[model samples]
Target: MSMNTLPRIEGPHADGADPAGWCDATRAYLPQSTWTGLFPGGSATSAAKALLDMQMLLPGEEGRFTRRFSRAVPGRPRLYGINVDRVMVYKAG
Candidate 1:
């Protein structure tokens, strides 16, 4: 696919944000035939639900996931923030 036709994915950030909305936005950029393949056995909403459920079982961690686009001019790269999941920990001495 050409750079102009590349697909973009994003996640919810605000309180009460709908997860399905994020999936819908991503699905909009993809071809209809690829939707099923991209989100096998389920729609975007179902996929998001499954992911959230799985994340719940994992240990708390913090980090930033970054993405960069191919530069045409060969200079400083641009970084895109994908998602940030922060877990707070309080330790008492």
Candidate 2:
């Protein structure tokens, strides 16, 4: 995807603020172990990396202001609650 398509929106802070939103958004879909692995510290940096590594992120950057564009992991099986296929994850850190 082109850089222009990636939204420049900032995400929740890298610190442990508003963690419930992040967890609620991601954890239910991922296996417990996988969820733990991706967000051991519950930080936005980890969220960015996980989304990028999964090939869900486009690309852009700056200081603590990195940008990531992500969509749901398309073919991943739903391990828990509802499928998040329509979810689009955006993280900036």
Candidate 3:
């Protein structure tokens, strides 16, 4: 599966955020299966550029990308959402 970032609600850490929570949440929901090693896709910047290329930003316009936690833990701030850009390939046999 190919991974990509999904639109998220703006939060405090709008610039950058850890993806551990998102990964954990996804793994939890996904069915258990035998998996193979992960392969590199490309840099986030390249992905971002591809997104931007789809549209024309105003001169000097800047775009922002953020990845936040997928869920909240007790006493911890809700700082994450969903990220769709994380692609995973596995074999089931």
lDDT (C-alpha, whole model) for all candidates:
0.30, 0.35, 0.28
In model 1, residue pairs whose N, Cα or C atoms come closer than 3 Å (at least 3 residues apart or on different chains), thus clashing, are none
lDDT of 2 by residue, 9-91 (tens): 23333433212122233222333344456457666457656555654533334522132323332223222221223234433
Q: What value does the lDDT take at residue 47 in candidate 3?
A: 42
- TM-score of candidate 2 against the unseen true structure: 0.24
Error of 3 at 56 (Å): 17
Off by over 4 Å in 2: 1-42, 62-93
User: What 10-residue stretch in candidate 3 is worst by lDDT?
Assistant: 28-37
lDDT of 1 by residue, 18-92 (tens): 222121221222222343455676574464445345441122124321223233212313322212231111112
Would you list the clashing residue pairs of candidate 2?
64-93
lDDT for 7 in candidate 2 is 23
RMSD of each: 16.0, 14.9, 12.2
Clashing pairs in 3: 3-85, 3-86, 3-87, 4-84, 4-85, 4-86, 5-85, 68-80, 69-80
Best by TM-score: 2
What's the C-alpha lDDT at position 41 in model 2? 69
Off by over 4 Å in 3: 1-42, 51-62, 67-93
- Measured against the true structure, the TM-scores of the candidates, in listed sequence, are 0.21, 0.24, 0.23
